[model samples]
Target: MVKRSRRFVAFFLAALALVLALAFVAADRWSRITARDNAELAAQSVARANQGLLVSELQKFRLLPLVLAEFPDVAEVLADANPEATAHLNAQLELLAGRTDAAVIYLIGRDGVTRAASNWRLRTSFVGQNYGFRPYFRGAMRDGASELFALGTVSGRPGLYLARRIDQNGRALGTIVVKVEFDRLEKAWGVDGGIGLVTDPHGVVLVTSRPAWRFKTTEPLSRRALEDAVRTLQFGPSPPARAPLSLSGSEASVGAGRRQEPYVAGTLPAPIDDGRLTALVPLQPFLEDARRVALLWGLAILLVAGAIVAVLLRQWDRQRMLLQSRAALSLEVERQTAELRDTNARLLVESQEREEATNKYVAAREDLARANRLGTLGQITAGVAHEINQPVAAIRTFAENSTKLITRSRPEDAQLNLGRIIALTERIASITSELRSFTRRKTPVPVQATLGSIVDGALLLLGAKASSQIEIAVSRADREHVLVGDRVRLEQVLINLLRNALDAVGKRPGAIQLTASAQGDRMTIRIVDRGPGIDPAIRERLFTPFETAKSGGLGLGLAIARDIAREFDGDLWLDPMEGPGAAFIVSLRIAR
Candidate 1:
């Protein structure tokens, strides 16, 4: 039963675990999908916002170059006809460049020669330098306006060159150039965990949030593009690194860093421009977010599952307990019902037994009364003969002795002898009277009697048959030991025991010892015989009717004796010991 219960519990737990695991898995997948979408949106927003800043910054200075192209110091520097106007124009350009945050303001002739510049006074000035091969100069001569990023030939610093053609008389005279550097913009864009970088049409990073990434190409450069970059020296001679990210899909890109950290990128195109602005944000936040969501939701789902399982298990257990309790109650009721039936059967059996015992008692009483009368008459007859023989022999001896004294002329002696004869007759009469009374079947009448007196009377009756052949002696304390019982019945029991003792000692050297003692409410009378002990084989039924050891015995002696002893509310049993001879012990209630 216990094993089955445990198996049930184990199965329940396994089922609960399976349910909880499924719940956790489902919740984790859902959370992961939601988190991924959120990450994509977040990355795209960063990319677009950074892109707006880049475009706005570029627009802020876009008009400056176009406006500067219309300025005319009479075009005197380009013609070389007014040195005063050129110097004054140089000073004014310097002041304008400072105010507008441009790197340099310069003018070039139609031959692409640096005619006047804001840094004309400096050692590395663009003044008097020829930039006819530069793309911005070449493009400005052909087109009305041009914009290009290149390295300055005189200063060797990288900047975006915006140029416009100065046209007069249906021909281009010189170009007005404006150099834009975004040192402050780079600092603002690259700080505070947000980044933005512009990639050229050829996929090179022109400016970036991180300085280390500037001038890096987004894709592998071919031999031609490398050669072009080397020849121009626009970004120095260093081999540019590939951009950290590659386009992944519509809105996201896969990015790798120096240590190969995972990143997600969002790309945007510059409006009315030729570059791409991209924002690279680390994917760690998205991953962490997804992981946290998975973990928390998984735990919550499992907790709810466990709680529900607990409630179900508890409810199941309660039902099981109720069922078991009903079974136990049923068993208890059955057991009690069985006991009640058994008790009723026992009472019926006892009633039948009681009725049978009553019938047996009535029949036994009538038989006992008749048996006692017959037994009294028989023992009385034997006792009378035994008593009459002893006194008759003594009378004869005294008669002969008196006759001898009379013959010797002793008259006084003769008178004394006659008196003894009369006394002997009186004694004989007393013996006869006692026998008559003893032989009558009277109701058992208890009187105070000594143990010794009872034993002596029984011995005298047995005296007719070689009474001196076996010895009999009583202890002094037992001779006067008092008790209450019918003297005749006790005497009868004693006489039977002594007869058996004498017959056992026939023709052998033996002795009889009688003992008396008291225990609790009873007095014990033990008759011990030192003759051939009672036969062992018949000892078990020694007191049963007609069971005896003697050759002609009726075996009624012990049976009758034991019954008479118990008639006084006492019992008898043979001594259960290693006896030298037979020993019978009887107990009688002691008188108060």
Candidate 2:
């Protein structure tokens, strides 16, 4: 018996050892793969952020050349080469360059000779520089616009050149150029741990976080390409050297000998065509941290499992010894009874928890419905206040005037003023009544509501809060169009749509058109505005709750309006148009 017990112990120990060895290998492999993936994700995020900065910078500078190209001074300098016009433009360009944080803004004649520059006052001014050989100048002359990233011949600094052609009477005048440098951007990238690089189509590094990596070739260049690049001086006097980095899929190895380091690389295409932005993150740290954590967890689990097994084995031995005793049978009965009690207790607790969860869910749903109505009312609160304010002010004015007239024994005029006050008070009451009816969360009672009355009610709520510059024209035939819908709810839908149209055309020279047309048994009310159209970014989610373009909007008005329309078996939608501005169409059942 002793020999058998010893053999069993040895077998269990060997099994535990083998299991631990297998777990270690599996954990290590999994952790390494997970670590690399995490590194790649991080690298990708960095790459996108850096690329956004590059694109933003490029876009900002590109606008400068276009603006300058339209300047009369630029055309004057290009057409007549007037020294006074050139000097005046030079000062103007210098001031503009400073305000816009651009490196330089210059005008190139049709011959590709620089006539005026923002840096004309500087020692290395490009005022007399002949850039006829530069691709930006030639391309602008040929295609009317161009952009290139290259080393500036005079300053030897690298920047992007955006050029736009200046034309007068269909004659090519010259090209206006804006140079934007990324020194500050590069420095900001370098402050972070990872390396950032921007490469052109030919894999030539145009900008890099590491200055040494700039003007370097990410890949080998052909003999003809090298000669062309050198002759054009695109990268400056010295030929671009090969960077000490190699890429293989998502992995990268940088440096040489003992200093070599591995990285997880991620890349994104730049906004400019054929350009790419890359980020390289060190892989060693991630790998080490992940593996160490995984190993520790594995060891902790192995220790816990071993302790459990030992406890079980000791219990077995104790039971074996106890089985020889007289009280062993009683003890086993007690253990089974205790287990049964515990199971019954757990079942009772679970049943109670389920009941509580169901009750909470029902309450949450009720709260959400109430909140939705309140949110809709909140969006129109400002407009309602504006609608009531004018009448309140007029009532106050008429009340004061009546008191003065009564004291002067002018009873007739006093009575007239009092009547005016009464009329104003009635108007205020009407506004409040309309608002209160709109907010009531009751089922709609469909009734025949004239289209003209609905349009007038919505306009009353809008008031004169917006500028009088906007013309709201309603077609005369709308009065003949009647709809089968809840009058108050339909008015609310019109109010929402009209309010949006007014806001869209605010301070702009545009008119709001309220047109109604009949198709079979349905009537479609169209609210069209000549304002800037709906933004494409939010077009897909226009009717979604909490999706809004207005800064101070709650984004619930349209959603609530749409819901109200659908309650009467009608629908509201944005109509497509070939012209500028937006059109909202509300279709309802026409009165039979």
Top candidate (TM-score): 2
Q: What would you estimate as the lDDT of candidate 2? A: 0.82
Which digits, one per residue and each the tens of the lDDT, describe model 2 over residues 1-592?
5456657767888888898889888998988898999999989988888988888888888788778877889888888978898889999999999999999988888887899999998999998899999988889999999888899999989988888999999999889998888899898776768898888888888888888888898899888878978988989988889998887778998897789899999998976536888889999888998998997899798889789678756765765686686487688779988998999899999999989998787555334434554554565577668767877898888889989999999999989988888888898898777667665555547666787778766666555554243354546665667778777778878767877887788756447777777789887778889889999999999999889999988787788788778867799999999789999989888776
lDDT of residue 130 for candidate 1: 85
Q: Which stretch of 10 consecutive residues in model 2 shows the poorest summed lDDT?
A: 465-474
Question: For model 1, how does the per-residue alpha-carbon lDDT over 1-592 read when each residue is reduced to its tens digit?
Answer: 5457667778888987787678777766776566667766776898777777767777867787678766778266676648898888899888888888889988999987887888888888888888887778878889888888765666766678888888887878888888887677777776757566777787788777777777888788888878878876766767677766565553344346555554556777864238877776766677678878788877787788778667765766777788889989999999999999999999999999999999788557535533643564464466567668777888888889888988999889878878888887887886666566555556667756788778766655555454555455557865776766788778777777776776777645447776777777677888888778977899889988888778876777788788878878888788865756788888988777
Candidate 1: worst-modelled 10 consecutive residues by lDDT: 249-258
Best by lDDT: 2
Error of 2 at 471 (Å): 76
Cα deviation in Å at residue 475, candidate 1?
A: 99
In the predicted model 1, the residue pairs found to clash are none
